[model samples]
Target: MSEKQETPEQRRERLRQEEGRGNPAGDMNDAANRASNGSLVDLTGSLGWKGTGILALFMVLAFIIYAVFFR
Candidate 1:
């Protein structure tokens, strides 16, 4: 009797099944849950509008200086 060979799709399915058996929760956890309790901090609130504005102004000034003088 001749043995049946698996197709590419069948081989891929087998590999997926084996991976699922090895790590059942592999898909459950991801980069979205890297932060504990799913709480991504609000930098805007912590930094405040004034602080953020100052930072933005400084960044703009630096960019302008770089473009004007360096380039």
Candidate 2:
């Protein structure tokens, strides 16, 4: 018998497979939750369209300031 160490990605995939076996819709919800709450710019949770619009406005203002003042 041989043993192999499972990487984090492999572990997640295995767990997802196990989770899917029980409830199909649950797997989709789990994926949506993870995607919404993941570390890189969570868009769906607290950062709704209003926050996104504000952020975009700030970005555009910064760009205008940079072009007018710095360059």
Candidate 2: Cα lDDT at 31:
75
The estimated TM-scores of all candidates read: 0.40, 0.41
Least well predicted 10-residue stretch by lDDT in candidate 2: 39-48
Model 1: per-residue lDDT, tens digit, 8-34?
445655765677676768734632364
Q: Report the C-alpha lDDT of model 2 over 6-29, residue by residue, as the tens digit.
A: 754456557668879899898788
- Residue 56 of candidate 2: its Cα lDDT? 85
Each model's lDDT: 0.61, 0.70
By TM-score, how accurate is candidate 1?
0.40
Model 1 residue runs over 4 Å out of place are 1-41
* Ten-residue region with minimum lDDT total, candidate 1: 36-45
